[model samples]
Target: MTRKIFKQFFLALVALLSVTFALTTLATADTSNLAAENVDITFGTTVDADLPAGSLLKLNQPAGAIYPLHNSTGKLLSRGIAGDASTAPSLTTDQIKLDVQSGNVYYQVLPDCWLQSDSTVTLLDSTGQAPTDPVALTLKFVDANGKEIQDAKTFDAQFSTTTDATTLATLETELLAIRPAVTGYNLVSADQAEHVITYHYAKPTISTGSTTVATQPSDPVTTTTPIPAKTEPVAVKGTAIYATKKIGLYTSPNFSKATRKIWYQKKQRQNRPQFVVIGYAKSRSGQLRYKIRDINHHSLTNNRRGYITANATYVTSLYYHQNPKKIQVISGHGLNAYQAVTLHGRKLHHYRKGATLEVKAVKTHGLTTRLVLSNGHYITANKTMVIKR
Candidate 1:
């Protein structure tokens, strides 16, 4: 009986010890998690780091320990903050955002991290210490004719952690102050975007007619001028002429008669005036000109009949000049073959890049130009979208 009681007591002690060990392990795990959550993470200022221009910077953690970075989906981006002075993580990016309320800056610095800023980080100078490599901002000068006036100019534009509208506007103002002036051209509009700055200039029209016309019909001429034989005007049917750029609209075939009534602007490719050709007239100067009537509905020059240059440089046939058996799509995002020439209607099909399509004919309308496929559907004839095979 004594041995039995001793064994039972021993069994009870063993059970108590097992339960205590389990409870201690659970408590320790909970405490460890709490400590991790309470770790004092801090980001130092630029003064604490040795940052080399155009090189990777090594940030010193003098006050707090660095922690792993995570993305929005809770995916780990970095094991910890980078310590290398010569090489950062290959995935580290310069894209960053600034928190105004906390006066802290947040960086991606990792491929997957969507980091948020806290009070630990500080703001750097707006003009100094760019977060990323400088972006190439292109400045293009274009005339009213939609042609480049000169070679495009480019400059490096740097940004801080965040860019707001006011900051962008200020930068634009500073950049515009350096615009080069062109003779006989007045700046009409300056369009500004993040990476592109376009300045459109207009040149005032000057009379090209000679003022030396005979005041008296009986006045003796210095030399006799030979008159050329009369040429019959050629009739055109079902064709149109489009101004490749801005061209003058004349009331008569002869430019010496008067100055252009109006300058037809080619602001939008799809909405430009489409002049329906009726016939071709030879000017007194021996240049052939297109007798056209503007059929662009709702345009300022709509229904206005006039003469335009026949030079292929300034004007082009509304339809494709040559017929091709096949064409290939060149646009990266793929071109949408529409039901009609207009972009307002439903998309018939989408032709991906390098997609070869059979062509039936090329057609044009007031809205835009399109390629009529063999399947009776229309796709864009935009040179940027497709190419003849």
Candidate 2:
């Protein structure tokens, strides 16, 4: 019996040690997985240039890709215009461009500077003046083998008369003497920036130069890094009310002479606010204005959306009305869509006196309590129009 017990204990001890070794090996295993071990890059102000983990980058548009330019007011500045088609400067479809775009801050070349002219390319307003000569941009790079790259990249603002740069990488020129365009950034003053590009290569990979495999100690382990997701747009919150002792609507935020009259005059000073504010903007003079509307009513003015002077109106936090409930139109006829809750107002649609419309909410303006519809049009909640179902 003693001998049998000793044998069983010895076997159990070996099993335990094997399990312990397996667990220890798993605990020390490397999780980082990297494939481009021999590729690297660096750039920007004096910092070492290396691509952020888990990003792919490509430079320059493929040949045969054409892009058009536009003027400030948004007119196409085509290639064939006002003579100088053969001599006027323009970027070819194959012009070299560099854009550093990993995530949201995508550096893209814009055509904001180029202008249209009858004779020559003009300067962009952003660039005070355009230069006659093509700008000079510096470019440097090294391959994966750590060797200087020659003729791999080149750039020019315009054709040089003193030297021949026709065979170079980029040929950029102004449109009718205007500051020309660059990718991912704007020109300084009225001239193009002498952008400096430098590239750093990675260490070369070791090779046996033979078909047969060479013995290696072990493969290095690596972990995979996940890319972050992009963010979505959120809707604006809060509500704006248009109410006061007296109200006058204007064509613009400046309260310009062009007026959009919505009558809401109360004899007594009361906080009877109407209209929900939807948007905010500034006029040319920079006065603040709010986009408010008595939704479901006939919109004020000649337009469907109306704006009011925020400072002159009583602005308040959003107040939720009762949830939409179904109701029947038990009486009345001829309910015209008024631009507002008032009985005397602009007409939107002339409908028969009795029609079943969902009442989304109830809003009060002075003595009138209007039934708000899902589409933001309002109808009077008077006995002549609706009754409880």
lDDT of 1 by residue, 112-228 (tens): 332334333322333434255435557687987779976776643333324333333333432332334445555565666776768676664445485433222232211111111
List, residue by residue over 29-133, the lDDT tens digit for candidate 2. Answer: 321111111111111201101111112112122322223334323345542111122322222111111221111011112222122221233322112223346
Residue 252 in candidate 2, Cα distance off native in Å? 0.9
Q: Considering summed lDDT, which 10 consecutive residues are worst modelled in model 1? A: 32-41
TM-score of each: 0.30, 0.22
Q: Residue 59's C-alpha lDDT in candidate 1?
A: 33
* Superposition TM-score, candidate 2 onto the true structure: 0.22
User: Top model by TM-score, which number?
Assistant: 1
lDDT of each: 0.49, 0.36
